[model samples]
Target: MNRDKDIYVLLTDTGTVLTKIIRTFTKDPLNHASIAFDEDLNEVYSFGRKNPSNPFFAGFVRENVRGEFFEESMCALYRCKVSQSAYSGIRAQIQHFEQYSDLYKYNLAGMLGVVLNIEWEREYAYFCSQFVATIFKRSGVSLVDKSPLLVTPGDFQTTPHLELIYHGKLHDYTGCEVTAAAAGGSFRTA
Candidate 1:
């Protein structure tokens, strides 16, 4: 039997200048995307600012959900189930990226291509959503029927593959609590 495990998709609106610019184009409240390996989000990854204060110096990052950048961010969390082998594949892919992170860069140009409805794929470079979609695709999982280069944070919301688990302030998220509530226990939302 193939046991299943869950991977988390986190979308957020950090209210930064870059996010505001992205929000203007996408018209989506949440302009950034991340992947979390755990229900409590101890391991969250994204292609974003390397320094919290400098959006220009950006690339692969292991996000701290409790960081000042996310303290007041609005967010939506989704869960996707995958077979054990697929989970292992995803983990291996993340590890590969982590080991060679120096070779990667944030795909700012690709974000422009997204606005123009064009696909711009660069070697070792990815935007936030593109990175997440690429991870799933490379791991033999399809989150949506589209090219990873064309994937946007908003695409995740409309994809049938992901189950919406929580939507609120990132600071207010109690992952295990939310998980229990989603499993039919009572949950209080702020």
Candidate 2:
């Protein structure tokens, strides 16, 4: 877990009907969130749609921006440099969820909290934003004081430490400002 390095939080809109609905409700362009271990952002972890095209059947996923699902996505990148110990803790938490991903599920109910402004979280389940928030908190790098279950992709913007790195079509990204890693961590294998 490159502790001295930076961790990335990616806010995205894949332009799917579901995302459109979310944007309409939240009045925000970002509807999803994921985390990457490096600046290159080759692979990212999130609790989201398992299948690129299918919206249902979602869970903890290791997503790819260059993949068919996110090829058309609009993304905003943010980074945070954390302590080595925090990095190790974050990586360990992510790896733990990844290891038994099947035992975990997407917190579909938690999505309602965003609209209702209520806090809700299920055991062994998480939504993308909350999942990312939880990792940061568990790693001693809490993004915000808000409850992780109530966090949204837009909430990452409120975090004091998150630095904006890039914003544009994921398909069009070519490391204009931030060096898209020549190579990065790949999607995890189940």
* All candidates: TM-score: 0.90, 0.87
> How does model 2 score by TM-score?
0.87
Instruction: Find the candidate with the highest TM-score and give its number.
Output: 1
Model 2 lDDT tens row, 53-125: 6788899998877777776677888888888888889889888988999998888889888689898878988
Q: How many clashes (backbone atoms < 3 Å, residues ≥3 apart in a chain or on different chains) does model 2 have?
A: 1
Residue 9 CA error for candidate 1 (Å)? Answer: 0.4
Clashes of 1: 0
Question: Between which residue pairs do clashes occur in model 2?
Answer: 40-181
lDDT of 1 at 113: 92
Among the numbered candidates, top lDDT falls to 1
Give per-residue CA lDDT, model 1, range 96-176, as digits (tens): 989999999999999999999899989889999999999999888999788999888999999998888777777667542
Give the CA lDDT, 0 to 100, for residue 91 in model 2: 84
Quality of model 1 by C-alpha lDDT: 0.87
